[model samples]
Target: MMYRNPAILTRLALLVPLGLVTGAPAAAQEAVSVEIVPGAVSLAVGEEVTLTARVLDAEGNAVDAQVLFFPSFADGRSGSARQSIDVDRATGRIRAVKGGEFLISAIVATARNLRGEAMVSVAFPPVDRIDVTPLGGSTYVGVATRHRATLLDTAEDERDGEIRWSTSDGGVATVDRFGILTAHAPGSVVLRAEAEGISADVAYEIRENPAARLTDEILWRQKEQFSDGVGYSWIDSLKEMAEGEIGDGQLARAAARFPTNTPLTKEAYLYRSIFASHFPGEPAVRCAPEGPSIACSTPAAIAWDPAFAGMADPSGRAVQGVHAHSY
Candidate 1:
């Protein structure tokens, strides 16, 4: 799109192909028009192109005038549009940073109204490889984990594309379109991610959950779970009693009392106070189990059950027969 404002500049600037410019006399220096040479061009990523601006008189004679060049997206988009191409105002040298089409404008600095524009199109290279992290690893049945895949060009430049995920043995483990893998049974399987005809694979082995196995080994007595190992109502009874034993004000000041891993519940406060009476040392307090956990499971095992991530209790009742796996 080009327009001339005769009201702003007496002379007109015409954008045209590169051509010989005849010398203009001092009087002819009042350009009738200005133009940018090479009206259009196309280049690949990392390529460079230079544009020339000429202020011409009525007889197509070159005139003297300071010209500046600016680059903008042809489609009028912003952000990455500015990142796609770079231009030197004084030299009109443009470098393609990414694939996109842009318009290069050459304006007469003195007149401000006389200007010319050129079109430039940049091409992007193809994806040459796919890289997946944890190329090979092991997980447990009933456990889930997320994997990531990145696309790269031959030059190792990162590229953007949609990835399709799949699993070789669905019975053992399954992968979703977003690369989340869920272990269904015990076995070995291959996880694959594909994009632009390029694919990457990750080998995995699903084993029986050791937490579930440990329960089977030590489940001789009734309810052999933490917090409820003695009886299902034991912890509940203690919680009910603590609600009366500890006042609201005391629980509010639990942080000042225990300092480390401050008790958040009446049941927790009751237990902490009792433990402090027996072993009243900062080191012993610090040794108390802390961090996120579920059903006596380790912090890492919490990943297996998303619901466990925010759990404060280490009781085994939520996951009745499960415990943290040593492996």
Candidate 2:
């Protein structure tokens, strides 16, 4: 059965156990009223406070009695989701867990229990910083990734607080309340998380997904092959001219001339000589692609075929099995 007054139920719940343990009759321990010293207090999370309880007899004389502390949410509700406080039963010491108000009831450990209560207010500690994961990075358009934001106090201890997530450019990307980032288009944007007047940002770049445009029909329509599409004889003539114009001794000296990405083939040497005449610096060389590649594929794609690892030619026909005769 539910008691209208929770204090009455608390007393009833303790009577059976205390009576059985103390071997004291229900009428032996008598108390007219009880009072808690420093009846109200306010503190921050992780802070502690101690309370003292006193019992008085009908004659207004102080009585010696053991007191136990119990916490009930002052809002008249009890649930695990609500912020909680830890109270020591034997010693009226309380440790704040989160931001909330609580009512601490002190019961005299007796067959006839007399209760006293105090109010407690707890506030969250101030946030010193907000740390975000994957600080600044790149992702493909239409892809989604989860980001984390951690709030810390001045002591570098994690503090519990709500975080607000936002994107600098909504057109480029969007972030939800939980810090899940979704790329909408190809662009650069900044993601921000804020809490307790402290905020942090992460730069993100969203690029187009190349796999979506690799269809055979699109490839045939683009007509991207520079020399082969025009005439086969033209590329053969160019290769023969490069072989006669560049000697092996000049190819060996290619590295001394252009330290960055020295040409291995005579054709590559001829092209680098022409290009270097116009732009001759490390900055210009960085603008051009220079890596171990095959079949116009990236250096990472060399793992697909063992032969690709040894081939330096970037022609699409260099790949043995993948190239179709129709192309």
On lDDT, the leading prediction is 2
Clashing pairs in 2: none
Supply the TM-score for candidate 2. Answer: 0.48
lDDT of 1 by residue, 1-327 (tens): 789678544432332222223354333357767688788999988889899999898789898889999888889876545577888989999998877689988999988888889999987778899999867788998998888999998656688899999999899999888889999999999999999999999999889998776655476544446656666577668767999999999999988987798887787788888999999989998887765566567778889866666665655656633544211
Lowest summed lDDT over 10 consecutive residues: which window, candidate 1?
11-20
What's the TM-score of every candidate structure?
0.53, 0.48
Candidate 2 local accuracy as lDDT?
A: 0.81
On the 0 to 100 scale, the lDDT of residue 240 in model 2 is: 84
lDDT of each: 0.81, 0.81
Which lDDT value does model 1 have at 151? 95
Tens-place lDDT per residue, model 2, 78-110, is 564224688888989898887678988989888
C-alpha lDDT of residue 152 in model 1: 90
The reply for model 1, stretches above 4 Å from the true place, is 1-34, 56-63, 80-86, 111-114, 214-327
The residue-level lDDT of candidate 1 at 68 comes to 91
